[model samples]
Structures are given as C-alpha cells and as structure tokens.
Target: MGKIEIVEGDITREKVDVIVNAANSSLLGGGGVDGAIHRAAGPELLAECRDLRSSTLPDGLPPGDAIATGAYEIKKVKWIVHTVGPNRHAGQTDPQDLARCFSNSLHLARSLSARSIAIPAIGAGVYGWDHETVADLAIRAALAEQRERGGIDRIRFVLFSKDAAAIWSQAKLTHLGR
Candidate 1:
C-alpha cells in the first residue's frame, strides 16, 4: 500500500508531483484552498481554467470529479488536480460524493504517474462537512485507491490548521496505522 501522511502546512508550498485543489464546481477559483492555489499559481492557472470552461468542461467541474491542469508558477508542482467536494449547505450530503473527491484525485494522480500529492481538507472548511467525517472519508478513499491502484506512492494530506491535522492524523492511524 502507498504511504499516507498527515501534515500541518500550506498545500501551495508542498514540493510534490501534484497538488489537489479543493475547488468549487466552477473551477474558476473561490475562497479557501481554491483561491490560494489560483493566487499562488498566478494568472496562467486561471486562464487555463477559463479555457477549460470554454472548451472541454463547459459545464464546469462536477462535485466528486477531478481534472488536472498545469501548476503554472507554483514551485515544485507539475500538475494541479482540481476537485469539487459536495456542499453540505446545498443539501448535498452524500458520503459517497465526498469520498469520490479523494478517490478521483488519486486516480488522476496515478494516471499521471505522480509519485506524491498534497491534498487539503476538501469539504470541511466552507463546505460545512464536519472535520471528523471529512477526515475519515479522506483516509478511507485514499486507502481504497491505493489498494485498487498502486502507482501513486505517496499521499500527503496537508491541513491548514493544527486541529485539522490532528483529526486527519488520528484518522490515518485508525485506517492505516503507524
């Protein structure tokens, strides 16, 4: 199985093959992790997202699905995987939908032959999912993906706050052990 790590750090600063953006359905950048990633990656990233809307993903990225884009100016990141988590406030509370965000991101990372990836607390922030639930879902999805497909060797869950890191760490231990 691939190694899973819980880190208390900024996702934008990760030196990994891929960084997962907890994006909105628009993929045009919003608050929290999405805005930070777009700002760090610069205008090119936004342009690419806009181009995606104009072309292939005209309907915007759907929740639980993922799409990859160039990291642009974000140092040490080759690709950015954008995923829209289910918004609890919108009454989209299916656990499977939240789980798909992690699984799809890992699937895309493995397809790209990414050795490592940095992901954030996808729906826990503004999307209104509880930290404990998101943590469990994230860990479960990552482990499932690892078991089914093993190309992606490292999964680094980069949490912004200590509380989130602690939650994810505990979930990691529960699901993956020490």
Candidate 2:
C-alpha cells in the first residue's frame, strides 16, 4: 500500500497513477484546474471532453461525481478523473458536496486499481472556500475513506500556492497527525 501525501507542488508535475481534476459539472475545458489540465494535456484532451459536453449526461455530471479520461503528456498516470466541485455557498450543502467529490474520486481510483493519486484543493480557489476549513474536510474524508477501502495507498493534496500548501500542512498536522 502507498501512503497519503500532502505536498506543495504542481499537479502537472506529479507522477502518479491518476490525478483528479476539480472540474465543473459541464466537464468542458474552462478556467482553473480544467484549463490547466487541458493546457498541459493539449488539444486532444479537449477533443475527448467535447463529446462529454455535447452528449446528454443521462445521470448528470453532478457535483462530487467523477468521470475518467485517457492521460496525455503528464507522465506516470494512465488516466485522469474529472470530479465536479461545489461552488461557494453559505449552506452546509456545499461542504457535503465537496466531501462527496473526494469519495467519488477515491472510488473511481480504486476501481481503476490506482495505488497513487493526486488531487487539488477542491472548492478553495475560484469556488471561494476558506482554505483551512476545506483542507480539514478534504483531508478527513480522504483519510476515512482510505481506512475503509485500503485501495488508494497514495493520496496527495497538491496545492498551487504556498499559502494553500501551508494551510494543508497545518490541517494535516492538526487533524491527520502529519
């Protein structure tokens, strides 16, 4: 089994079995992680995503729900999981949805037999979430899920900024015991 890692780095730079993209429900290439992943993965990634956007999502790409795609230049990983994140809100629903995102991604990674996976701080950027709070929820959810399935040995929270990284670092220390 691998281990949980809270690292300060770029998602594009991480070499893992799969990287989860904090994407919109549409699953189309847009700003934030979606744009970054598309930019790094090239136009072919958009080409593949086009079909998902055009076709009707019978079950709907609800928040916290994830879908898979083939990996591009980003090395080591064979697949990328696109999970929808909750937008900023003053209600408990947002946190609940955010937690579901982790759950869904973990499930997908396990189903794919992926031992190493990386994820961004979901809902902490454009979504307008407080970094520390979201970090606690995300880390706790990931750790709890790990304890249950024992599938994802390496689960990483790849932060884009030093501030975000520091928040995760503190949260990991205070909650997950580092």
Candidate 3:
C-alpha cells in the first residue's frame, strides 16, 4: 500500500505528480480548491478546461466521475485530475458518491503512472459534507485503491488549515490504525 500523509498547506504548492481538484460539475472553475488551482495554473488551464468541455465533457462532468487535463503553470505537476464531488444539499447524500471522488481520482492518477498525488478535503468544502465523514470516506477509498491498484507511491491529503489537518490526521489514525 502507498503511504498516506496529512499536510496542512496549499494544494497548489504541492510538488507532486498530480493534484486532485475537488471540482464542481462545470469543471471550468469555482471557489475554494478549484479556483486556487485554476489561478495558480494560469489561463492555460482554463483553455484546456474549455477545450475539454467543447469536445468531451460538453455538458459538464458528473458527480463521482473524474477527468484529467494538463497542469499548465503548476510546477512539478504533470496533470490535474478533476473530480466532481456530490453536494449534499443537492440530495446527494450517499456516501458512496463521496468515496468515488477519491477512488476515481486515484484510478486516473494511477493510469497516468503518477507516483505521488495531493488531494484536498473534497466534499467537505462547499459541498457541505462534514469533515469527519469526508475524512473517513477519503481515507478508506484511497487505501482501497492503493491496495488494489498499487501504482501510486504516496497519497497526501493537503488541507488549508491546521484544524482540517488535525481532523484528517485523526481520521487516518482511526481508519488506518496508525
């Protein structure tokens, strides 16, 4: 299994093979992690997103699904794997959908032969999923993928705050028994 680490830092600054964006269905750009990624990656990222929308994901990406695009200006990152998290207020209460956000993103990262990936607290942001639930599901899905897929060498859960980091750390200990 790949090693899992929790870090309190900006996901944009993570020098990993890929950075997982907790994107909305639009996939164009939005607040929080999505907006920060786009901003750090520059306009080239937006252009690629537009091209993706024009050709493949024209109607926008769906919840629990993921797609990859060039990382553009983000240094040391080869690809940006974007996955739409299910919004609880939108009646997406199923935890499986949240799990898919991690599983699908990790699957795509493995397909790209990414050895390291940095992911944020996906559904815990604007999607309104609680931190504990998000952490549990994220860790479970990532650990499962690491065992089943085995390409990724490192999985880093990058959070924007110390509290978030602490929550993820506790979740990791609870789920992974470390």
Candidate 4:
C-alpha cells in the first residue's frame, strides 16, 4: 500500500519523482500552484506548455484531466503533472470533478513509473473550494488509488500554509481513523 503524508511547505521545492500542479484549464500557467510551478521550472516549462497547446491540447486542457511535462528547473523532480480542478462558482460544482484531478494526476504519475509524488490542494485556492472539502477529497482520492491500483509508493500533500496543513492533517486522521 502507498503511504500518505502531510507536509507544510512549498510544493515547488519538493524533491519527488513528480510534482502535481493545480493548474487551470489553459495549462499555460495561472495564479496559485500553476504559476509557482511554471516559474520554478523556468522558461523551459512555458515553452513546453506552449508546445502542448499547439500540438495536443489546442482547445486547452479540460477540468478533471491531467498532463505531464518535463520538470526543467525544479530540482529533484522528473515530471510535473498538471491537473485542472473544478471551479465551484464557475459552474463546476461536482465534488467528483475535484476528486478526478487527484486520480488523473496519480494515473499519469503511475504511467511514468513514478515512485513518489508531491501534490498541492487542488481547487482550494482561487477555484474557491473550501479547505475541508479539498482536504477530504484529496486524501480520499489518494487512499482509493492506493487500494485500487497499488503501484505508487508514497504520496505527499504539500501545503503552502500551516492552516492548510492542519486541515489536511485532520482529514488524514479522520479518514484513516488514527
């Protein structure tokens, strides 16, 4: 089974096999986690995103879908899996859509043979999802994937704030009954 841990820090600096970016549908880099990952990964990341847009996702990546790109400058990370989470007020009110972000990212990571991945709180930032909901959905998705697939070794929820970390920690405990 895969182990899940909550870490309070910047997701951009995580030294893992893959880093999950809570990206917008554009996948061209927006505010929050997407911008951070793009910036941290340097201009090469943007260039790659542009290539993806021009070739594959010309209409832009849709919510609940994920794509992987080379982690050019981010130290110790091989790939950056970008997933778009549902925007609640923008008409994407389905919790399942939010959950799909994690599942799709994990699936992409597994396809790349990634052993460990660091993920941020998808949909909880500018997307307007509540912290508790984000935490619950993220943890549940990870745990479900672990049980159903059982390939990835470790999953880390890297929160940018102490408050977010606390919420994720509580959710983890609540879900695991620990």
lDDT of 1 by residue, 43-152 (tens): 99999999999999999989999999999999799999999999999999998999999999989998988989999999997899998999999998888777774567
Alpha-carbon runs more than 4 Å astray in model 2? 56-60, 89-93
Tell me the lDDT of model 3 at 105.
Answer: 96
lDDT of 2: 0.80
Error at 71, model 1, angstroms:
0.3
Off by over 4 Å in 4: none
* Each prediction's TM-score versus the true structure: 0.96, 0.89, 0.96, 0.96
Tens-place lDDT digits, model 2, residues 1-178: 3466788887877898899888877776778777888788877777777777777564447887888888777767788999877877644355888888888888888899888899998888777788887898888877776787566888899988888888888887887554
Off by over 4 Å in 3: none
lDDT of 4 by residue, 53-166 (tens): 999999999999999999999979999999998998898999999999998999889899999999999999788899999999988888877886656889999998999999
Model 1: lowest-lDDT 10 consecutive positions: 143-152
Better of 2 and 4 by lDDT: 4
Candidate 4 Cα RMSD after full superposition onto the native fold (Å)? 1.1
lDDT of 3: 0.92
Candidate 1, residue 54: the lDDT equals 94
Shift of residue 66 alpha carbon in model 2, Å: 0.8
| Candidate 2 collision pairs | 2-153
| lDDT of the candidates, in the order given | 0.91, 0.80, 0.92, 0.91
